[model samples]
Each structure stands twice: as structure tokens, then as C-alpha cells.
Target: GKAVFDATRPDEVRQFFDGLEPFDHLVLAASGGKGLGPFATLDLADIGSGVDEKIRPQLSCLQAALPTLNRSGSVTFISAVSAQLAAPGVAGIGAINGMLLTVAPILAVELKPLRVNVVAPGVIDTPWWDF
Candidate 1:
């Protein structure tokens, strides 16, 4: 069964896990279609936010799922290649991706036996790239 809850809302995120049975794995991928373009020309407000859309929500999910995510259950975060390559217009995406890469290891240490890992895929032929 799939339930729809706003990932941005801490309360909703918590309620979600509270409803789920003990699970095997938790995969956190790029959820929202954020990461607006051309860093220089884009709005600062757009890049500055998306805590629910980009980073903080992961923490919220982890915190909420701590109890339900069983021992040996893994948490995988799918980031972009921007973190490594640092291409021309990927400033915002790169920064956030880098942060995620940095935190995955720390989470692994903190949540021992939970098997945390990060997957950063290279440039995808997605609509986002149609700039």
C-alpha cells in the first residue's frame, strides 16, 4: 500500500513512518523537480530553498523512519554527478549534491548496521537538461 504524504512536512513525514510496518529498505532519491537553471540568472529565493524539496527532508525521513527501518535495512540516496564534475551551470545542484554525499558517510556511522550508501549518477537525458 502506498500513502501520499508531503515529505516537506515534518509532521506528515513522521506520521508516514508511524503508519508503515517495519520495512527492509528506505531509498531517498531526488523527489521534487527543483534545481532551477543558469545559477546567475535564476532567482536566489528559488535556489536558497527546497528544504522539503532538496536536503532537510532527508533528515526528517531518517529521523521518522529510525524506529521502523529495521536492522540491516539500508538507506540509499540518489544524487547527481554534478557534485563530482562541477559543470558550468550546476552550481546549486552541485552544492546540494555535495552536501548529501558528505552526509551519507556520517549517517552510516551514526546508524550502524543500517547500511547507508549514496548513488550519484552521471548526466541524465532528462527534461531538466533541455536548457
Candidate 2:
């Protein structure tokens, strides 16, 4: 089932998933908070947008989808390798991605029986790149 959800409002997300029958799996691959440039000249104000975009939405989606997910089903989150392999110019984005690394284990344990995992892809071929 394809549906657009407002991740900022978790209640709405929960309501959306509540309407759907239990599913075998749920995959969350949305990401935001881009273009932060290097940390030296970074604006501290972007923190809210950064956190709101990635961390909040991801959690909201999980909380909403968990109840409707099959006990033996899996929840796969699409994160980036920058979470652990933070290179230059990625300090900001890396922090956001790192949050997922810390949370997956806790969620796996807390949400027992349901598998929780992450898929951190490296630089991949995409249509957006003209090269």
C-alpha cells in the first residue's frame, strides 16, 4: 500500500498505519537535512530542521508501523554509511545518521519478536547523477 504520511505528526502516522492491516514488513527510506556544508561555518540554527527532518520522522514512522507489523516481520530503515564513516564536510549529516545506529539495537530489544535492521548504502548509481 502506497501512502503519503506527515512524519512530524506522529499521531497522524499512527492513524494512517492503524487503518492498514498487519503487514509482513515496513521499510523507511526518507531523509532530509541536506546542504549543511562544512561545520566550521555551519549555522547552529539548522539543528532544528536537521533533527526534525531525519530523526523525528524516522521514529514517528516506526512507532506508527510497529503495532501493525507482524510479530515475525522486519522493519528495515535506510540509513547512510556516513553514520559511522563520517568523512569531511559530513559532520552535520553524519550526526543525524548516527542516531539510527544507536536506536536500532534498542528498538530490536524493546520491540521483541519483530526484527529491526538498517540498510546503509554507500555511494550508489542513481539517475540524478549525469555522470
Candidate 3:
């Protein structure tokens, strides 16, 4: 998947995962999950390049695999605590996390028989912050 996606364009996403089968477990994460922002003003190209490019294809792939997913399969999406907590320059992170958190439950409910869950992590000691 790319870095950003146009949620409205399902076809683009679907085409990417046309032949792949579902797995027993799926985990999703994003590099942009961590960052400070006032929500960068982005154009279509930026959206396509930064977000849609990354997430859309992955989601399309997942949606394509949903029907064939294992009966007991589990899908987990990694979000951030920013979904619940607010901070300065975290608007974009919070929005994205919140969207994933909200979508997780819906997916779980709608994709019954297939478990869907989200792991929202808070600040942790990671190599990215070591610098």
C-alpha cells in the first residue's frame, strides 16, 4: 500500500488485490501514526502521494480478501492514543487514529465470524525516537 489513499476510490484499491487470498491474521500499521501536525494542507497529488498511495491499496487488498478470509481469522489495526487524547500539533494523527479506531469496531461487527480489533499504543520507547 502507499502512504495515503482516496477512500472514495474503491476500484483503485480493489484492483490492487484482485488475486490475493485472505490470511488467517492481518495486521496493519502506518508510519504516519506518529507525528505532530496542524493537519498539513495537502492537494490531491499530496494526498495521492502521501496517504492514498499507502493506505488505499492495503485497504483495497483487505476488502478484496474479506470474503475469502478464514472463518476464525483476526484483523488488527494499529492506531494511536491520539485518537482519545489531544495534544498540540497532533490534529492529523488524532484524526487518522480516530478513524481507524472507529472503523475497527464497525469492521468487527460487520465482519462477524472474523474478529477485528485495533491496538492503540501510546508513546513508547522506539528506535524512531532514539535520534
lDDT of 2 by residue, 1-131 (tens): 47777777778878898998888988887667462468898675665665787778888888887777898999888777777775787677677777888889899999988999987777777642342
lDDT for residue 23 in candidate 2, whole number 0-100: 89
Candidate 2 error regions (>4 Å): 125-131
Q: Relative to the true structure, how large is the alpha-carbon lDDT of every model?
A: 0.77, 0.77, 0.62
TM-score of each: 0.85, 0.85, 0.64
Error of 2 at 40 (Å): 0.3
How many collisions per candidate?
A: 0, 0, 14
Candidate 3's residue-wise lDDT over 42-63, tens digit each?
2324333424533454455567
Ordered by lDDT, highest first, the candidates read: 1, 2, 3
| lDDT for position 80 in model 2 | 76
Candidate 1 error regions (>4 Å): 125-131
lDDT of 1 at 81: 83
lDDT of 3: 0.62
